[model samples]
Target: MKTSISLNQENLSLIPSDVITPSYDRDKVTTSIVHIGVGNFHRSHEAFYTNELMERYGILDCGICGVGLLDYDRRIYNILKDQDGLYTLITKELDGSLTARVIGSIVEYIFAPENPIAVIEKMANPAIKIISLTITEGGYNLNEATGEFDFSNPVIVEDMKNPMSPKTVFGYLSQALKLRMQRGIPGCTIQSCDNIQGNGDVAKKALTEYIEKTEPELLPWIEENVSFPNSMVDRITPVTVAADIERLKTEFQVEDQWPVVCEPFKQWVIEDQFITGRPEWEKVGAQFVENVIPFENMKLRLLNAGHTVLGMLGALHGYKTIDEAAHDKDFQFFLKAFMNEEVTPTLGNLGNIDLNKYKKSLIDRFQNIYIKDLISRICLESSAKIPIFLLPTIKAQLQGKANITRATFIIAAWCKYNDGVDENGKSYAIEDALSNELIRAAALSHENPIRFLQIRSIFGDLIDNKTFVDAFLSSLKMIREKKIKECVAEINSRLS
Candidate 1:
């Protein structure tokens, strides 16, 4: 029987040699980026790339100093700190192979709830030239209908009152930039790693508006010095549960409190704009392009929208995980047809990307048995996700006069899923910013399907379009009358 070796800086040598440990000296690496929302996605994706750069090219200056803004982040902070800012990254391949490595790009972490000023001071340091974010889609606090920062949010309102001790991401960014300005430190690039389309522009608008309202004097300096470069980042990193941690310990004989488990696919397409220089991430598989918009549109429409469809419709069909749904032949056919027919038409011509191959890769990624990505995780924040990911494709299909049968079915599935009952009549929590409002509307829409489309924030002006309303109603009625799998089979047959 083998005993597990505790993972930490002191025990690096004791860990099994088969597991790839960091080659670069961790002490030699210096912080150059301050990343907010140091969740599993950041660790698995960005940090993994940075770690690879340090190992392969001896780029030690681009070390990451992670900042956790929310109180809940304290747990992750503690886990990473205990391991001396080192963690395990396990990639699960579709063929049932696993690659385990120790990533060491994050040299320090600050739990901002404990010392918000420390986070600000770190960001103000000229050494920290880039402030990246992965605060999720809802973290931006944008008005869904207007596509602008929502100042009416209680948190934003409170942040406006006390900008010195800020609560939200905007508040923290404002204070940090002010400190940097006072010190005459040049502005740093604000990189958004979130899933939102044109994420950098979204961040720019939100941060600029917040500063304009809170500190009018800082607006001119921000406009002159700051840069927000849009980026497209993709990776299927699931939330690490206890089972993942135990698996690392049991299988690999490495004791890790928090280990990130993800599929063996990662892509980051960034706009090549940085104020104070950045890591040569391209060497480590990051793409720096002149414009990330086309890549962004393709990924958001096909991959993200596809995930939403799987989440809503799969849950309705009583599938708990993505792999489970992908295993079902009907669900697989639904995904392929939806992508090939509905989504492909909306995407523009890519230079070299074979869209068909990309769709097939997405299917393979979804079917990775080792990645137990819960459908509920994808289903979370549907109110925010649908508007950003799925709605654009729907609007495009409508404008182009293309067949929207699959898109309409996805919306209907969402509406039905919002009712808080699964296919087996099991009541589950519907997690969303507008859960109550959605549930109320979903209840009414059972009789009048148009009532759900009247959600102006999510549906926008689509409710006024008769064609959209009719298709939505027809799909919703089919879903209500027939089983979810049966409804998918019917849609597939029609498309066939």
Candidate 2:
């Protein structure tokens, strides 16, 4: 049986930008969500739902005004403009399910840094009820150890000195809040859509601190007016590929170059907090919880953390995609083993996670052939990711009798990956915030495991519990000598 959805004029072309045109009828769709860093994940997770909202309910004013950080984003800004804020989202299923949907939620995209005042004007618009971000972990400009804004960063320093020519998200946020305060527009809710614990709270704290440190004048108004709703967003969207185009054409009867694909499983757990209220997102299968802590912590620590571990090890082990890595039963076994043995104990409060159900879903998502997320994308910001995602488990393991061996191998593999060269002696670009420093440190760590783990920011204070450090160091040393695959096998043996 042939399965293809006929495309409307917008989605009928090969180039994604060919179909991008501003929806004339979007006057009904006001900017309710102001999103920072208009990346693929944001498009897949949050904006995808917003599109669902409008489609299901005929609700208007559920549009997103995308805010890019720099003038360099002019390229994307222009492309999205051509589409008139419309694009295609191609969702793939593990059990061979698929959907080709055209999303028209991003009403406009602006390179905010190019015109700071205009960006502020857009943000300060009373119609904008929520400010959501997918700036990623590293994009938060936080110090790895401190979990606070790193004003010491030159970009932040520049932002502090000249808020208008801002280089940091904090500066733009505070400046926008100031503008909002001046106009008496209620400051919008700040939503964090990244894979982080206390995402909204983190954004709130970071932005508040930025204001306190740099623009004390805006702090009072911000404290009273803003809402920061914690949330958990999950999906596995890889960068677009050429095959996706042919697939789009064959499946959706549309030609889109940048169609996004992901495993059909999608979940959004958001706190029911919004200024001027929110879309009845629950109408579109979003879970509005009283507290998003358990969900956020669970997903961030287990799922995202696992994705990273698998991604790095998979690459080092010469696998290109997550599914390929997952197909290696040995690799998949290590993943499940670590999650169960080491990570679970640390997360006692994960109520009703339904581990078996989750595992089945996880395996399916990872093994979905089409949702080909690259290992390197997941490898960024190990400095930020490891502390939240893995360290707590490591700490708990140290406090208990769980084998630290598997955990040790992961750390070792990370150190090895950070050493920054592929098996062919070709250098893989390590595009992390602290890439150079990490490469330098990882290189030295191979020589002195103890000294390497001592890096306070990357490993944090928890690792100093000598017991964990010793175990971790031993594992790292062994892995460096034995290689990841062999070390993983050894670690699994210890666990078994």
Candidate 3:
């Protein structure tokens, strides 16, 4: 165990025999996909699948080349570069079992901010057929109210003025596609791995609108040639901490600089639309469907919405991790009711999906102790998440005139959580783009509970609904006056 070797191409042989490593020759693999925002989720989910295809099925032509746009991505770029684009992935199961694998799917990386031209050149390469993204929901730079690409954003403004020296993802894509057009190479597919509804369509809209405003001549060509396929990806990959790195070194004798720890579950349902071509990912457990809407809806509503519910209430109840909160009986009961009564009614028919079984699996996933998924991580960016994950169900329930007390409580808990203080009076930072605005609103809500609803961008027209208003106020008051468990019990009692 003391002879742990640093993870890299040269040290691959020193890695233990029990751990799975790439089977194909790394040098022979060529890059066909360029993934932006190469964070932990991409490592654990998309890159892992590609690695599977390469090792098991000899799919060497579709290797991934990671591109990092923002300054924060420098950390990832350094880690992957040091390791020769190799890292360990450890999947922790519910029953305390572990699976360790060294993934080498990312053959190369580009820190785009440092050298934008190189990134564009790589994208323009005829060999790279797909450009994918895991840039978070906020990264799309869309106006929430209008759902349009925000040209007024400072970055977009800068990109518009100097298109060749681009900064934003849309800018880079536009320039790269222009290069490809000039070189007479076929267009590549633009795949969005973000969690937004109709993510591919969103990516297409954002990129095309950027082109329309800055370079109108390229818009028509982009529209005709490029295809953006919607995809639904699911995996509970936690933020890798120091403990995870040490755990890999101690247990597996592998010193991965940026190892990712996740639960033993991953699902990717992609629309089968590729311009040049795509890997036979279906051979390695990926689902290629005509439409990805149903699967997207199922995962977003059941898993993501449930995470928000647990996150807000869990943070307020002094629970640090999702598994800790999910293990509590009251938390579990409230979550089930919220999903069945409020969320499920809003969902359309999920083809061949057993709703109850899916719900059960979500609970099991959340309660996986070995994963140590932090509640705070889920609670990050509540402003963006509330609108995307929780609001749709609330809107649907209101239209149907269904009981939405639990759904309303989800919002109320978020409001209270935004106050930057937990039930034990401990202060925590509100990690959100709108943290300042949300904190100011939360302070005002303490004096006038209606103030939080008036944030039109987040609440929209729902603020005027008397039923939702009353329910949210009532829940917020109960959470302020009583313990979270007591508030949950009171809400459940009303349901009974």
Cα lDDT, model 1, residue 345: 83
Going through the candidates in the order shown, the clash numbers are 0, 8, 0
Measured by TM-score, how close is model 2 to the native structure? 0.90
Give the C-alpha miss distance for residue 376 in model 1, angstroms: 0.7
TM-score (all chains, Cα) for each model: 0.98, 0.90, 0.98
**Residue-wise C-alpha lDDT for candidate 2, range 1-496, written one tens digit per residue:** 4444333334434333433333335667777778888877888888888887787777777789998886666766776776666667877766676666777788888887668777777777888888888887777777776777787888888887887777667877888888889888877888899877888888888888778887788877777888898898888888877888787776546644456776688899999988778888899999999998877767876788788778878877777778888888778889988777777777776666786688667777888876778887778767777777877777677778676666666776777888777554657777777777788878788667666676777776755577677776777777667656776777667667
RMSD of each: 1.2, 3.7, 1.3
Residue 402 lDDT in candidate 1: 88
Q: What lDDT score belongs to each candidate, Candidate 1 first?
A: 0.89, 0.76, 0.90
With candidate 1 superimposed using the best TM-score fit, by how many Å does residue 297's alpha carbon deviate from the native? 0.9
Compared with the true structure, the alpha-carbon lDDT of candidate 1 equals 0.89
Model 3 agreement with the true structure over 166-247: per-residue lDDT tens digits = 8899889999999999989999899998888899988988888878877788987887788999999999999888988888
- Model 2, position 282: C-alpha lDDT score: 93
| Ten-residue stretch with the least lDDT total in model 3 | 206-215
